[model samples]
Target: MHRLIAALVFLFCATVRVFPHADKVEDRLVMHFATGGHPPSNGRWEDINHRHLAEVKGTPTLTNIGPAVALQFNGYTDHMLVPIKPEDLPVTAISLAAWVIVNETMADGGIISYAQDNGPQEKGFALGFDERSFTFSLATEKADDGDGKLTRIRANTPLTAGKWHYVVGTYDGETMKLFVNGREEATSKEQGGKILYPAKGRFTIGAYIDDNEFHAMDGALYEAKVYGRAMVATEIQAAARQNRALLDHESSINKELKFVVAPYLQFGTRDSMTIMCETSAEAQMLVEYAERQPLVSRTRSEEARLINTVTLSGLKPHTQYFYRVTCTDKNGNVARSDILTLQTAPGPETPWAFGIIGDTQRNPEVTKRATDGIFALRPNMTIHCGDVVDDGFAKHQWVSDLFAPSATLFSHVPLFPVIGNHEKNAHWYYDYFHLPKPEYYYTFTYGNAQFFMIDSNKDLSPGSEQYRWLEAELRKSKATWKFTCHHHPCFSSDENDYGDRWKGKAPEGFRSGDENAQRLVELYEKYRVDVAFAGHIHSYERAWPILQMQVNQKNGVRYIVSGGGGGGLEQAAPQRAWFTVHVQRGHHYCYAAVHDRTIQFKAYDLEGRLFDTFELTKGR
Candidate 1:
């Protein structure tokens, strides 16, 4: 009886093909990382049961999200390498599945890959993202290169940030498929034959690795599994269902996502204009612009990065163009801006108008109201007299206090700005604005008028570099009109700028305007500058054309202080100074339209009340 029973049991075990205590799901997995490497194998990630190990390349930390533990890549320099043999990867069919959460948009980075080369074209398989486009990549005999000629496939889904996702990519010998959240999202049939692969390649996780390790990913990665055979829709769905339990807690973080900075125009000229916007997280940027037709062009970052600054070229001079920006995170979340329009700079002889404002610091509501007035006028461009933000170092203020409030005006009008005292002379100003070399002090001529934008925060004394540049610029300019803009005033009559006369005539030390700024009066006198615009004090003051401390309407430089853009109101002296012709204390913006040698200058308050108007005309 014992002999018969033992013989029967042995036969049953042999036919059943049973050995380990793994579940059905685990039985099919050729290699698996259960806890970013459970049973923590020193500094390596050991497969759940298989001896296939991955050498941790960079410093990957551990994070416990909800009920699961994951490995975190720093995005800039973290990855893993599992040495893989040709036989280890199936030649006919294979599937790769992972639980991933991307921290930012990987403009060009890999999630997991085992490829032959690193160039645009290679011979292998990879799952990655580039320029807002994310997909599964597999190479075959029919493919021309590794990446471009029908070598990659992506779903129309957008990748979002701050959420865990289960993704699977597979090849079933005839078709390539991508599954997200257990559902098939994308499929292709170009790679029909056996997959072409590298003999001594390594399976890279959380980064792009082919010839070498290049693009590293940021965020956490959970169990990643590999199967030698193609995983059917049911198997992928089952696997995704199992992984979904651990992500129930982290699913609410995306409910209140912050948007990127509003789109703004910059570096605008006759033939080009740069449309710029910044994302809260790293994102791939795509800018589309059109003149008369649906002219579409795509742009990708040289690498996955944070800022998108694209210059639209081949634009027609004095022509209007419509543009918009779209940003995509690696997880397929997309954000797009509204379409806006801007006209390129007209020729010097063209009749055009530009608006000017100053001191729009720390007052959002007033700033918005003041800028709306400017936008309605539909000027060719807008000029900021400086102090765009109260604290230049606090980077967020640039978005809230400046960009957000003036979004409407800036979307359509390119802004030319001068640095103000409130800007703190920080590098952020230079990074935000795209201008000529040494952007702080530069010159650009538009529509018969030449503008010299000066950085009064820097030294403007007689022997300073700015002095020499101004001398050379003004001496050679032959435009119909010449204008100079600096933050500090060359002439002012604010209550205390000249002197704090609490109740009397005031003390010494204080002058009519900034002494350093006043020193440039000779240049205005010598060159016969049309207007000297400034914005230090928070009030509007239009001085009579002054030549040598006297009002000379014929050939003197007219100085105007349109400092009422937004700020606490200030008053003129108890007794008005000589340079002050007209003064107003309110939030306002100024507009100037130049036709031939004549300019019509008008200033209006937030109520749309024209408080000041003047005309300056020159002879032929």
Candidate 2:
């Protein structure tokens, strides 16, 4: 009985000790939207002091700040409603705070949009954010139509997603201020004068609400607090120091790491393959697999890391195996992943299938459709020709736009990617994927075919590093089928990207097929490369077999421009060029089946429409 009573006492003490601001000036704090809660779904957060209570709606996921866990809105229909009697509303001087992580930028996202109307009188003000920047808005009056004419001041720092922030906005009768983390970012003296409160009011969190519809927030809010009196700079700064401690605690939630990017396969050769994943914390990773019996392997890095890669070798060629990844943080807390599978490459005589996509950027929804379609095709492997993300430097897009859509496909199949112009040769790309030395250009052989991945963003002309490497590699490749892929099309029926030949106008900068990449045409012809693939035009085009820039069906190379991965669809040249055979503008992915001396390829749009098909045979 004594031990249970002691535990209860500790729990009571912990519940009340939520924030530094509240502990410092308990009487001045009107409410903290999330005072004490377990991984909350939806319920009431009543002020312990009996001042106010917030009604939660929909389900907000749990998010942690420091040691405190708060709610994260889904940006669609999640919100919290706080009713404030006239006596509780801050009328003249007010301060608002939100510990947040914003996922998307929006025009009217309300970290807190406040307004309370009582009969003919309005009694509240709103606190909202611009995402890229935070804004503090105050108004002395509202229009008769019931809209506030707020005086706004903005902070400079962009509130990027996937990180924590301590944002504060305040208004004292003479000045308005906005602070991020703990330092002052902006100030304004526009609204000034006395603000009024009516007989009753309301303070809302997670959304902007009034007589107008609610503008939901696309972020996680660790806490939202209201102070009856505007806090001075020194007090706010001191409170920020305490916030820093809380954020430090946020480093690892619940004492364990989370899977940021789930386990996926990479670099699969006949006898070896790599298993990779990323976690939120620097943690040691262990991978277990089974072919006929269970086997274990540790990550390559001796030190802890957010990215963990495990290579499994000495396996049978063309064999399948099931595997799972486990992450263990320093505290010994563990996270385990579901079991998945992978297949090793087969010998040259075995048949194989693969999927190809290009320019998968900016549109994850469409990308998801394409990826799902590809997954349905059950290719043994996948290739992203280039432009994997809208900006290769923006690491978040790599997860959101590329990896998310990859879904079940990547879990089972390996991916080989080239560097596109959009990648900008960012370090994140290199860190995320374990590729060969000089990652920008490399070659891989699977079954009977060999793929040459080029970095079109670099100089591929004669004498350039990629040019010399490709010439040497192509000459040495004795595979039955040889294919080359890059970002810029060697032959595309693209209109403006190439010169606007229909109007007889030279392109401002770009041309249809890259002149530099086109230089490889001579090399491809000489080496008898079967097919050249690229994506930059955001459409699908296949050129007639050509040699020496002229049609040569007997022994010439074919060019395919399959840019329609996820970017907005683009158009082909107004009229077919001399080398054009088929051109279709749409979002798409391609799948191919290969066997000795024969290749069967097909293209499909997002809705699973089989738009085109063709076959290539050696020594036909």
Candidate 3:
């Protein structure tokens, strides 16, 4: 009897040692991606918790971390997808955790997801990056139509590219929480009963399984784990704490490089230019520049700050210059940027081309595509009619949504922007762009054209300061061509009209129409402006030369609404207005060439298809 008891005790001890956390282990799915070999040769990646192996597609490489393994995705077609089963679906509460090292910031891509098959009626959860922010989303079917409606919670801080980050998303039946770097960043109240799963659901990594809209991640993911039960904050923190040494090593390497936003050209003119960028910390900034040769001239900022601006003066007109920026942090860690080139504005009557695009606020991918199209045209300069970002106060939106995507374009071509309503007159807009004095409403002359960038969000009454200043500038301008760019439109047939009425009664003081539009239009007409560009509506509309609401092409001023610059498209009214000559609903931009006394305008959609073209000759 004693010998039997000893055998039983030994068996119980062995079982306890094998299943350390048996109670929690049964409700979790852990995938280490440590398939001992590379892809194509290594058929599948097994989930250590369950035997549910995921089929690897495309050429996914492998990397070693000490004795462990991690998968490297190419951001194109690399993905690991598992067929969904009854055991894979979460019933009530769920948590997803992953360690990722993003190589580049994408528009939208999933890190880990489980989604339904139907295109629009998909129901599931995904942890990914919406543009640049870490986001956790839950999609539920509508009670009426069964269409999917998404509820999302995004982290306040953006994840740094080329760095490892620990991310966790948890839903406890009432509230959804998103944690980044082991700290809670955002939360949302989602009181859904049970997580919904469609008939053809799938669990995928590196991309959305069912939707083609979301892009694949361009990064490396390690140790992806999912729990059927809600994971508490302590558990998530503990998991992240295990990698504290790894994160600290990364942080030390990052500190060696102090630059955050690279040096980009801004506020360029014939004899002057501004080089602006941001560093990771307070650093002394300097720019060494010369004309098409080794650096000979240097300009240094007097103060040490994160945001560095160095203006180079005495630059030759219509000349190209090579330059490089260097920054040194407090720790004596020096960072040097790549060599960049910049060309000053052309001399008067030199025949230059400039591009116009606006409302590039919400969508970064569309904005990048449109900017690339414009860049291919090789414009001397670019003009943005405001709404540079969806939320002006949100600094992340400016960096990720606007600045980062347009960095390449704006680095070469100087951008003169107007203030849109979305900016809310925030100081961030003023701080970012190096505009003329009274940055909101200012005029700049490029080549033979004098461009007026107005703040349409503020009051533009006849007696207002902006109105008076605009009148004075117009009266004094001696340039051959005069163009005005603002946010709100005096005439728009699109559904986004501020007052709903497209053709309203003209106010007494201003002849254009009621509201601020009337006063602004009167100034444009009185000043004999060649063409006025406005972009509040999210569609392209070009009006005939209208003077006092009448189409008089001779002395009237033309209005072109080029608001379709990456923002969501808006549909125009069915019945076209008398002044509306051409209208198209799509993402588009305008390219204008000025030579002698004539200006040629061509509107091209995102695909480079020319939809509208017109020429204006100044009656000299």
Residue range 164-275, candidate 2, lDDT tens digits: 6778888787788899888899997766656654333446688876664467776677667788778777877776676565544333322356788888888899999988
| lDDT, residue 454, candidate 3 | 87
- Per-residue lDDT for 152 in model 2? 67
- TM-score against truth, every candidate: 0.61, 0.59, 0.58
lDDT of 3 by residue, 59-95 (tens): 5545432222345665656788876674557767888
Question: Which candidate model has the greater lDDT, 1 or 2?
Answer: 1
The global Cα lDDT (0 to 1) of model 1 is 0.77
lDDT of 1 by residue, 10-121 (tens): 4433432332335345545677765522423456777767677788865665544444445666564578888777666777788888788776675557888887665554
What is the descending TM-score order? 1, 2, 3
Model 1 ranges with Cα > 4 A deviation: 1-258, 299-301, 330-332, 505-510
Report clash pairs, candidate 2. 66-246, 114-126, 498-511, 498-512
Work out candidate 3's RMSD over C-alphas. Answer: 20.5
Question: Which candidate's lDDT is highest?
Answer: 1
Model 3 shows how many backbone clashes? 0
Every model: Cα RMSD to truth = 13.7, 17.0, 20.5
Candidate 2 wrongly placed segments (more than 4 Å): 1-255, 292-301, 501-512
Deviation in Å, model 2, residue 460 alpha carbon: 1.3
